[model samples]
Target: MLTMIVADDEPFIRKSLIHVFNWQEEFGIEIIGEASDGQEAYELCMERQPDILFTDIMMPMMGGLEVAEKLKAGNCRARIIIISGAQDFSYAQSALKMNAEGYILKPVKLPELREVFHEAVTRLRQEKDHQLNFEQLRKQVQSNMPLLREKFLQNWLAGLYRDEGELWDKIGYFQLPFKRGDVLTAGVLQLDDYQSAIDKFSEEYRQLLYFSIQNMITECLEKPPGGISFVASENEFIVIFCPDQAAAPGTGAISSLCEEIIGSIKKYLRLDASIGIGRACSSASELEDSYKEALAALVHTFYTGHGSILYIKDIQPGTAALQSTFFYKFQARLMNELKAGHTQQVLELLEKLFDRLAAPKLQIDYVQSICAEIIFTSARALYELDEDIEQVLEDRLTIMDTLYRQKNISGLKTCMLSLFYNLSTHVAGKNTSKNSKTINRIRAIVQEGYARELSIARIAEEVFLTPNYISLIFKKETGETLTDYITKIRIGKAKELLHTTDLKIMEISERVGYENPHYFSTVFKKNVGVHPLKYRSGK
Candidate 1:
C-alpha cells in the first residue's frame, strides 16, 4: 500500500482532506500522518518516508513551498501535491519548478484527486515490474555460461577450430587457463556397460544418474589444478588436463590421477570405468591429436577388459584384419539358419564365429563390428516374418548394449546365443494354431493393461499383428467383438469395486479405465439397471 501525509494549518482543511474520499479502500493509499504546519510535514516525511505528501501553499510557521524544497534537498522520493487559495500563475510556475505533483485551489474534486493518485500507482507498478524482469534476465545469463562454455570445449575437442586466431579468441572468451605454449594432454573415460546398467530405469532417472556421475568427476579433478571435464557422448566423458609448466607431468602422476577418478566412480556410484590417457602435446592446437590418441586407447578396452587404465604409449600395434571371405561365409550361413528357425544350427554357427574371433592378433574393433552385424541380422529375420523384433525379443533395446559390454569373445557368444534362441522359438511358434494364439495374446494384454488405454491399434502393436486381423480373430475365437469384451471386463471390475469398496465414484471410474466420471455413470447405469450411486447404496 502507498502511504501519504496531509499537511495544512487549517484544522477544517486537514480533516476534509483526510475524509474526502475512500482513499485507502479505492486507491490503496493510507494517510500515515496529519501535520498542522510545514515543519511538522517535513518531520513527518523524514520519519515515515511516506510515498506521497499533501500540503497547503500558504500556512503558519512555514509554507508548503519551503517543505517541498527542503524535502527535495534531502533527496526525498515522495510525490508532493501543493494546495493553494490563489489562481496566480507564479504559484503554479513555482510548483512545477519544485516538481510538485499538483496545485489545487481551496476546494478539491474527487475525479482530479483520483486521476493523480492512479497515475502514481501505475508508475510505481511499472517500475517494480521493470526491476523484476531485469533481475530474472541477469540470473538466466549467469546460469547459462557454464553450458555455453561446455559447448565451446566440446567443439574444440572435435577439431572444429581451424584458425589459431579463432581458437585463441574462444579460449580467452571462455576464460580457459591455458596459454599459447602450454602443454596439454587428454583422457577419455567411459562407464563400462552404461546402457545395460541403466536399462531398467526411466529416461529421467538415467539423466539424473549421468548428472551425478559428472558431478563426481568434477569433484575428483579439483586437486589436479587445470583439469576440465565434460560429457563427450552418452557413455563417455572427456577431460583435458593443462599442467602449468613447460613440460607435462611424469606418467606416474597422470596414471595416479586417472586411477583416482576411476576408483571414486567404482566406490561411490558402484559402477566401473576405464580411462585412456593420450601423450601430452606442446600446445592447445595439438590437443585434438591427443584427443584422438585417447579415443584409440579407450577402444582397446575390447581387448584389455573393463576398469583397466590404458595409455597410448602402452598400446602394441597390430597388423591383422578380418578375412572378408571368412566373414561373409559365416554371415550367409548364419542368416539362413536364423530364418529357418533352426536353433541347434544357429548355436553351432555362433560357436564357430566366436572361435574365429578368439584368434590372436585379430583386430578387436573388427570383432565387435562383426557381432553388431549379426545382431542386426537377427532383427532382419524377424522383420521378414512380419513380426517386430522388439516384440519377439523382449530384450531388443538391451541387445546392442549387451553386445558392447562384452569384453571377450566368450561373453559375446553368450549374448548372441540367447538372442538367437529367443528368435528361433518365435519363428517356430508361427506353425501352431495361429489365430487361437492371437486371441490368447489379446486377452492377456487386456487383462494386464485394463487400467491403460486399450484401443485396438495399441493392442495390435503389442501383439505384432494388424488391428483388423486381431479384431477378426478375437471375434471368431470368443464369439464377441473385442470392444464389447473390453467393456464387459471394465464394467465387471467396476461392479465388484462398487460392492466391495467405499471408493468414490470418480476414483472407481479411473480405476476401471474411464476418464470421465459422467460417462462412467451413464455406462454403469446401462449395464446394471441403476446409477452408480444407487447401485452403491444397495437401493
Candidate 2:
C-alpha cells in the first residue's frame, strides 16, 4: 500500500525513477502518478498523500528541492525521498534541511530502495506511537476527572499556569462545563479522631470509612439538593447548582441538614462527624470564594471549638471570638519536640490537641482529621529520619481517610484508645521518660489475650484492677471503651481464621469468643458487609 509519485523536469528521468522499483517485488511501490516538474509534483503530492515521494534535484521549471520544501512548509504529510545524480552534492544539504527521510543517487539500486522502504515504515510507526500516547493521556485525565480537575485548578490559582488564556485552555481540555456566572455550592467533611483510628486499625477498616462518608452525605444529597450537580473530591463534595435555579439548599435548612447528617452518620456509622456548609455563589469563577469561606468555617471549629455543625451564617466572618492558636501551633511544636527527643513536651502537646478535639461539640469526622494530622505529621517526621514507619503511617492515613464510616463515637474512641496506648507504650516508648507500673501491667495483660475470650470484668480481675477503673484508664490512655476494643480484637482474630484456615463459620465463631454462631454472624455483618459464611467462601 506504499503508494508514491515520481517527479523530475525531464520526463525520462521521472519515468526512469518510477521504473527503478519493481512496483511489487522490491519495494511494493505503486507509482500513482508521475510529475514532470515541481508544480505538478506538489499538486500530485497534495492530492494523493502518497506514503513516499521520489524527486530529482536538477529540474528546469521547478526543482525537486523546492517541491519538497513547499510540501513541508505547507505541512503536507508525506515522507520524501530525493533522487539526485551522483555529482549533485549541493542538493543533499537542502533535502536534509527540508526533512526528506532519504536521498538516493540516480541509477538507483534495488538494495537501496528496499532500505528506504523499511525506513519509511519505521518513521510511520513512530508517528503512530506518538498519536497513541496522546490518546491514552487524554483518556486517563478523563477517568480521574474530579481529582485531576481539582489539582489543576489549584495549580492554576497558585500561578502554575502562565496566564488566563492558558488556564482557559486547560479548562476546555478537561471539559469542566463551567462558564462565568454559573453558581456552585459545596460541602465540607472532617474525620473526628482520624489519626488514632488509623493507628488502631488496618486498611480493611479504612475502606469502611469511605463507605461511611458516602452513606451520611447521600441522605438528602441523593436528590441533588436542587440546583447543582454533585462533585466529590477526597473528603469534600461540591454540588454545582444554578444561579437562577428554582431552589437552593436554604441557608438555615442546610445547617439543620448538617446537624441531621451528624446524628444519622453517628447512629448508623458510629463515626463522630462534623460538617460545615458554605454560602452559595453566583458563578463557577467565584467558587473559590465559597470554597474559602467553607474552609474558614471548617477550621473555625478548632477555635470556636468542635463536635457540632458550624455554618458560615451562625459564625461571623471576621474576629468576633478570639481564635485559639493552639491546634495551629501544636503541629510544629509537637514535631519539634519529637525531634529533640523531648518526650514529656511531645506528650503534653499531643494531649492538648486531643483535649481540644474532645470539646463537647467536636465532630468525630473533623476530630479524626486533627488526630490524623497529628499522627501523620509525627510519622512523616519519623519518615524523614529514615525510620521504618511506613506501615504505621500508611495505616493512620487510611484511618484518617475513613473516619466517616464509624457508626458511633463510642466505637471510634475505643479503637483510638487501643492504638494510641500501644503507640505511646511500644512504638514511641523510647521517647517517654516516665511510666507507671499499673499502665505497664495493663498493657501486658491486653497484649497477652487481646484476641481471646477477653472482657472488662475478666481482664480487670486478671490485672488486679476494678472493672470501672480499668475502663476509665483504658479510655483515657487509648480512647476506646473496653468492650468495643475486646470485640474488635476478637473479630479481627475471626477474620484471620476465615481467610487463612478451613474453619467453618460456627467453628470460627467459637474460636473467637462468640458462643452462638447467629450472634457472631450478626456482629460480623454489622462490622463487615457480608455474612461470616460468605466471607469464608471468599464471596
TM-score of each: 0.42, 0.40
lDDT of 1 by residue, 402-422 (tens): 676676555677777887888
Q: Pick the candidate with the highest TM-score.
A: 1
Number of clashing pairs, model 2?
41
**Residue-wise C-alpha lDDT for candidate 2, range 10-39, written one tens digit per residue:** 777667666765776655567888888788
Each prediction's RMSD to truth: 31.4, 26.4
Relative to the true structure, candidate 2 has a C-alpha RMSD (angstroms) of: 26.4
Model 1: residues with Cα > 4 Å off, grouped in runs: 7-15, 35-49, 55-111, 125-188, 196-215, 221-257, 275-305, 308-539
The lDDT, on a scale of 0 to 1, for candidate 1 is 0.79
